[model samples]
Target: MAEQGPHFLMVGGVPRDWRDKRTVAEAVFNDPLPFLDVESAHTHEVLSSAMAAELVDLGEGIIDVASVRGRNRLLTRAIAGAHYSGVIEI
Candidate 1:
């Protein structure tokens, strides 16, 4: 049997406070890069950790793309305009 792969997504949203907690909502859709939300039903933490591991410069800070176009631009730069592959947790 083939092993299931991790899902990835270029998430973008505005920072907001909810009951003294931070959250992001009102998400927008990009050009459907790659869909893979199979693990979302299990645990969000696991998903986050996997993404962090894959991302090289995922430092301790909030980087907002705020739009699909912005995310595409970032991806292009991150992968040096190469045909990169990843999944989205949409």
Candidate 2:
């Protein structure tokens, strides 16, 4: 038998109003351990332990990409643009 993997329930929403230009998305997993697994270092940015803790305290890991700084900000902007353009849903 093949090994089974954790399952994730992903939900995403965009506000009816575009004033804030923000999207809310969540990934709920059956197992918490798999949530921290990164398939590739080049494709993923590892958050510091402190940062992860902070996110857990603040909105349960949901981030306001507009308020993010540095390289992540750029990545978020691209994703947001793609979402708005209908290239991607979430």
lDDT scores of the candidates, listed in order:
0.38, 0.40
**Compared to the true structure, candidate 1 yields what TM-score?**
0.20
lDDT of 1 at 24: 44
lDDT of 2 by residue, 1-90 (tens): 556445432245433574255547657887543222223332233332323554454433533323343345444454344434554321
Instruction: Write model 1 residue lDDT over 3-72, tens digit each, in one string.
Output: 6445432355323442237444556787645543333433234333444443445332222332212444
Q: Against the true structure, what is each candidate's TM-score?
A: 0.20, 0.22
Worst 10 residues of 2 by lDDT: 34-43
Residue 54 in candidate 2 has what lDDT?
48
